[model samples]
Target: MKTLYLDAFSGASGDMFIGALLDLGVDIAQLRTELQKLPVHGYTLTADRVAKSAIYGTSFDVVLDHGEKDHGFIEHHHAHGAGDHQAHHGRHLHEIVDLITASDLSATVKRHAIAIFNDIGAAESRVHNVPLAEVHFHEVGALDSIVDIVGSCICLDLLHVDRVKCSTIADGSGFIEVAHGKMPVPVPAVAQMLSDRAIPVQQHPEVHTELLTPTGLGIIKEFVTEFGPLDAQSAVQQVGYGFGKRETGQFNALRAMILTTSQSQKQTAVGHDQVTLLETNLDDQTAEGLSFAQEQLLAAGALDVYFTPIQMKKNRPGVQLSVLVPPVDRDRFVTLMLKDTTAKGVRYTTFERTVMQRRFETVTYQGLPIRLKVATYQDIRRVTPEFEDCKVAAQKLDVSLETVMAAATALAR
Candidate 1:
C-alpha cells in the first residue's frame, strides 16, 4: 500500500501543507483550477517561492481582491493566508459550505471539503456552546480556509495512497492573540477539536505559539487514519518543509514526508513514542450495526476493538465502543462511526503501552488443528494455544475445557 508520513517537527499550517503537497508531486495547475470554484467576491490562489531561515522552498499563497474589507486587498506574512479576517468574523459555517458547493469542482472533492469544514464547525460549536449553524469560525472561516480544504482534498486524491499517517503533533507552548482577545497556547477551539476527535497531541517547552492551527488540525482530524512513527509501506520519495512564522528555539521547522510504493509492501515507522485509547457510547445502534462497525474498524486498520456497558450522560445506559488505534487512525475511526452508526460522541486520550514480539505456530491435538501464540523474550520462544480457538474446538468436539487444555499442554511439550 502507498502511504504518506507527516513529520510535524516544527508545526503545521494550511498553506505550508499545500506547499508540501505541491512539492510531493501534486499538480499545482489542477489545484489552482479547482480553487477558482469558491465563487468568493474576488480572490486567486497564487504560488510563489519564499525563503525560511535562508532555505528557499515553494510557498502557496492566497491573494484576495478588494471586496467588502478595509484595505484594497489583504496581504499577510504567513503562507497559510490571514486567518478569519476582521470583516468575515461573524458569518455562519453552513453559509460558507453552501458557497463552496455551488462552485465548479468535482462532487467528491466538494463533499470531502464540506465534511472537513463541518468537523471544524462542530468543534467550534462544542467549544463555544452554540449550535453548529451558529458557530462563527475565528481562524478557519475565511476564503483561504476554503482553498486549504479543497486543495488538500485534491492533493490527497491525486496521491491515491492507501493510508495516511502522522506523528504526535507538537502543539507548541505559549499564547497567541485571537479575535476574542489573548488566548493561551492552542487556543480553545483548536485544542477542543483535537481532544474531541481523540487525536494525540504533545507540547514542547522550548517552542510555543500554537504549532497546530485549527485548519491544520481539521485536515488531520478529517483525513489521517493512524498516528505513529513512519511504519510506512513504501520508500520515502520526497521531503518538504512548510515553515511556520514563529521561531521555537532551534526546532522551528515544520516538515512533511511523502512516500510512494517501491515494492508490493514495505514497513515504515515515523511517529511519537506514545499510545492512545479511543472509546464511544453505542446504545442506540443495532447489534448488527455494532458488530459491523467493529469489523469495519478493524478492517480500517484498528489495533483492537471491544465493548463495555456504562452509564452515560442524563442517566442513559449504553455499550461503550472502545478502540485501540494509533493516534493518527483516531480520526479515520471517528469518520467510521459518523458513517456507520448514530453515536454522537467519542472520547480518547494518551496511555502507556508495552508490546511484545509475536509469532504464530500450529499444533495438533488428536488430529484436531490448533493455532498457537508464540512470544519471544531474551531470544527464547514461549508457545501457547490461542484460548478462544481452544474453546471453539472443545465445544465442536463435545469435550471438556480441561481436555482441550491438556491436549494443548502435551503438544507444546
Candidate 2:
C-alpha cells in the first residue's frame, strides 16, 4: 500500500493540497476529468507549473467571477494561470453537499468531500452562533473551495493512497482581512476547527499572516490520521511540491511525498507497539510506598511495572522502578511515576515490543466466572486462567485454589 505524507511547512490550503498532489504525479487532466462528475458548473479547475521564492511546484487554482470571496489568489507571488474566469453563484453547505452527493463521482469521493464541508460547517455554526443546517459558507462555500476540496479528494482516490500523515502545521500568526472584516490570522472558524480537531500547530515568531486556511485545516483534520515530523523509516518514492499563494521570505510550498511501509509499521500490523521504558531509582521511599507506586503505574496503563533491588551511592540499598508503556502514554506514565514515587528524577528510552494479540473471555465453572486469557502468535496459541478468578471460585466453592485452577485450566483446554 502507498502512504502519502503531507508536509504542512507553509500551512495548508485547499489550493496547496491539490497542487501538492498534482506535483506528486496526479495527472491534472485526469483530475479535471474526474471533477466533472460534480453537478456544479461555471468554474474552471487549473494546475500550472509555477515558481515561488525560486522553488518550482504545481500551483492549483479554482477561478470564478461571481462569489462573495475569491480564495487562493495570493499577491507578491508569481504563478501561471491554469483556470478560466467563469461566472457562478456561491453555494451553502447543504447545497454543496447535495451537489457532491448528486454527482457521478465515486461514492468515496463524494463522502469525503461532504465530510470535509461538514467540518467547516460545524465550526462556522459554532463561531457564528447559527445552526449547522442553516450555516452559510461565505468563502468556503465558494466555487473555488468547492472544486479545490472535491478535486483534491478525487486526486487522492486516483493516487490509491492507503495512509495519510502530516507534520505539525505552521499556522501563521497575525491578522487577515476577511468578509467579516479584519480578524485573527487563524480566523474564528480556523481556530475553532483546529481546536475541535486537536491538530497540532507550530508557531513561528517571525511570520505574521494567515498561513493555514479553514478549508485547508478541515480537509486535513478529516483525512490525515497521524501528525508529527517526518517518518525516518519509510522509503520515499516521490516528492510532490504544492505551492501556496503567499510571499513569505522562504519558499511557501507544501511538500508531500509517497512512502512505502517502514519496518516498524509492518510490525505494528501484527500486534506490536512502540514503547518507552521509564526508569528511576528510589532510595528514600518506604517499601509500602514503592509497592503502591507499582500498583498505580500498572492501573494507569503501564504494560508492566516492577522493582529491582539495587545498591546506590554509599552502598545504600535502593529499588529501581521500571515501567514499560506505549509511546503515546509515556507522558502520563512518567507524570504518574513522579507524583507517586519519591524519586526526584526520571529517565525514559523508546523501543519496540512484539506483543502477542490477546483477549479475555468469561466462562462459568462451578457457577463462578473464570476468566481465560487467550493469546495468539501466528499458529501458536496459549490459554491461561486468571489466578484471581480461580482463587475466588475456590473460596466460594469450599475447594483448594489449586483444584479450582486445575478445573478452570481443563475447561479452557
Candidate 3:
C-alpha cells in the first residue's frame, strides 16, 4: 500500500502542506490549471525554495493581486487597508460550499475541499456559539487560505495518495491575534476541532506562538487516517520539506514522504494494520433504539457496526453489538457506545488484520458509468462492481439488477 506520512515536528499550515506536496513533485503548473476551475480570482500562486534554520524546503504563497490594472476590485479593497480585508473577503460556509460545488474540478477534489471547509466551519460554529450556517470564515475564507485548502487537496489527488498518516502534531503556546481579537495559542477554533476529533496534540512551551493554524488542523482532520510513528519496515520513496513562515529558533518545516509497504515485506497477503474492536451485549434495548444507536455509531466514524444474535443471562434473547474503529478513535467510540446505547459497559480489544490492496476504476455499461472495486493480494485479484452504480444502471437500462452487475463485473474482469 502507498501511504503519505506527514511529520509535523514544528507544526502545519495550509500553505505549508501545499508546499510540502509541491516539494514532493506535484507539478506546479498542473496544480494551477486544476485550481483555475474554481470561480475564485484576484490571486496569483507562487512557489520558491526557502531555507529555515539551515533546512531548505518549498514555500508556497498565494499573493492577492492588488494591481490597479489586473485586479481593480482587490486594489479598491486594499485601499481600505488591512482592517477591512476580513470584511471584504470573509465568507459564510454555504457560500464557500456553493463556490466549490459549482467548480469544474474533479469530483474527488471537490469532495475533499468541501469536507475540509465543513470541518473548519463546524469548529468555528461551536466556538462562537453560532449556527453553522451563520458561522463566518474570516481568515480561512480569504483568497490565499482558500487556495491553500483547495490547492492542497488538488496536489494530493495529483499524487494519488492512498492513505495519509501523521505524527503527533507539535503546537506552541501563548496568544495570537485574530479578527476577533487576541486568542490563546491553538485558538478557539483549532482547539475545538482537535478536541472534538480527539486528535493527538503536543504543546511546545519554548516557542510561545501558534504553530498549528485552523486551516492546518482542518486539512489534517479531513485527510489523515492514522496517526503514529512511521513504520520502520516500510521503504521511503521520497521526502519533501515544507517551510513555514515562523522563526522558531529551530528548523520550522513539515516533512512529508511517500512510503510503500509490500506484501513480501511482512509476508502477508497484502497489508496489515491494527484496529480496535468494541463489543457490548444488550438485552434491554428496543429494536428501534438499537437501530438508532447503530446509525449514530456509523455516523460517528465507526468503521463497521453490526449486531449479532446471542443468548444472554436470565434465559432471554439478546444481541451483541460490535463496532470496528481505528485505534486512535477507541475512546470516542467507547463514549458514544455508552451514551447512545443502554449498555452499562463496553469491551474493546486491539486486533491486527491483513487487508487486500484496493483500487477503483470506472467502466461504461450501456452508456452509464459503473465503478469497479479491484482488490489485489499477492498474485490474486478480485473485481467487484459497486452495487449502487450497478443498481442505477439496471434501472436506467430496464434490466434486472443481477444482469447489470454480472455484465459490469465481466467488463471489469
Candidate 4:
C-alpha cells in the first residue's frame, strides 16, 4: 500500500508534520490555497529550508499578524514559554467544531480536523478533571494551531496516503513551563493524549525539554495506524525531513518517508504474514475443562483454537490442542494454555502463511440483510453467508439454512 512512515526519533509537532509533508512533494501553493478555505485569518504560513545539526530540512511556521509565531519545539530560549502564546485565544470544543464544520473544506478534511480537536479537548478535560465541554484550549486553540492541525490533514489528503505508521516518539527529560506552571517533559496534556490512546513513547535524557507537543500527539493519534520500524520489503519512494526549533545532541527533525510495499504492487488477492502455531497435548484434561479453556483462549485474542483427537504414549487417547495466534500474542497464549489446561508445557512455531484477501458485502435476500464473506485468491473467489445471518433469515422465512445460504450467496455473486 502507499504508506507514510514517520520516524519520530526527535518527536513530532503539528508544524513539523506539515513541513515534512511539504518536503515530501506536497505542493506548497496548493496547501496555501486549501488553508484559505477555513474561516479564521491573521496568520501567514511559511515553509523555509532550514538546517538542524547541519542537516537541512523544511521548517514550517505560522506567523501571526501580532508578530507572534508558533514554534514546533519547546525550549526555554523561545519567547512565550512552553505552549504559551502571547496572542493565545482560548476556544472551547464546540466553538472549534463549529469553526471546522462551517468551513468550505472537504468532508474528509473537516472530519479529520474536528476529530483531532475533539481528542485534544478530551485529553485536556481529563487532565484538568473538567467536563469536555468546559475544557478551554490554550495553546491548541490559537489560530496558528488550528492551521497546523487542518493543514496537516490537507497535506495527508494531497498525498493520498493509505496508511500511516510511526516510530516510538522520543520525548525529552526535565520540566517545561506552561500555562499551568512547570509540568513534566511531556506535560500533562501530551501525557494524557498518549496514555489515553496507548501510543508508544520514550524519554531522551540528553534533551531536557518538550519535543512532542499536544498538537503533534493529537495529529499522530488521529492518523497513525501502526507503530514500528519500516518494513524491509517496502521500497522507499521519497524522504522528507521537517526540522524542529530545538538544538539537541542529535538532529531535531521528524523524518517522513513514502513507501510502496508489495501489498500495493501486486494485483493478486493473496497476502502473506507470519503467525505462531501453539500446540500442546493434554491427556489428563477433562472435556469440560478443555472446552472452557478453548473459549478463554479465543476470548483472549487467539486467532483459532481447536482440539484434535490423537493417540499419546501408552495408547492413551489424548487431545491435541492447537492455537493460532498472532506472533505478538504467542507468549500470552502459551501462558494461558499452561495455566488453563493440564498440559505442563506448550510448543510454538512461527509459520509464514498465505491467505486470500477477504471482504464483506451485505445483500438483501427476502427483505433480510445478509452479510457475505468474500475471499479472493488470484482468480478464485469464495462466497459464504455469515451463519448467524443465514440462521436468522431461515427462521424468519421458514426455510432451511442451506436454502437461505444458497440464496444469499447467489445474491452476493
Clashes of each: 16, 0, 0, 0
Q: After TM-score superposition, what is the CA distance of residue 280 in candidate 4 from its true location, in Å? A: 38
The residue-by-residue lDDT of candidate 4 on 1-413, one tens digit each, is 47899999999999889999999999999999998989988988889987766877899988888776432222222255466554256566788889999989999999999999888777777777777765566566778889999999999999987569899999998988776578898878888777756788999998989999898998999998789997654789999998887666678889999987542222334489888999999899988999999877765556788999999999999999999987987776888898899888898899999988876679999899998788898898998888899999999999999999989999976
RMSD of 3: 14.5
Name model 3 segments beyond 4 Å from true.
Answer: 67-83, 267-413
Model 2: how far is 225 from its true place, Å?
0.8
RMSD of 4: 17.0
Please give the ranking of all candidate structures by lDDT, highest first, separated by commas. Answer: 4, 3, 2, 1
Q: Candidate 3 clashing pairs?
A: none
* Candidate 4, poorest ten consecutive residues by summed lDDT: 69-78
**Which numbered prediction scores highest in TM-score against the true structure?**
3
Query: How far is 55's C-alpha from truth in model 1 (Å)?
Result: 4.2
Residues 280-385 of candidate 2 have per-residue lDDT tens digits of: 9989999889889877676444667888999999999998999987687677677788999888989999997777777666788978999877778899887788
Worst 10 residues of 1 by lDDT: 69-78
lDDT of each: 0.69, 0.77, 0.83, 0.83
Q: Which stretches of candidate 2 lie over 4 Å from their true place?
A: 65-88, 262-413
Give me the runs in candidate 4 sitting further than 4 Å from their true place.
Answer: 69-88, 264-413
lDDT of prediction 2: 0.77
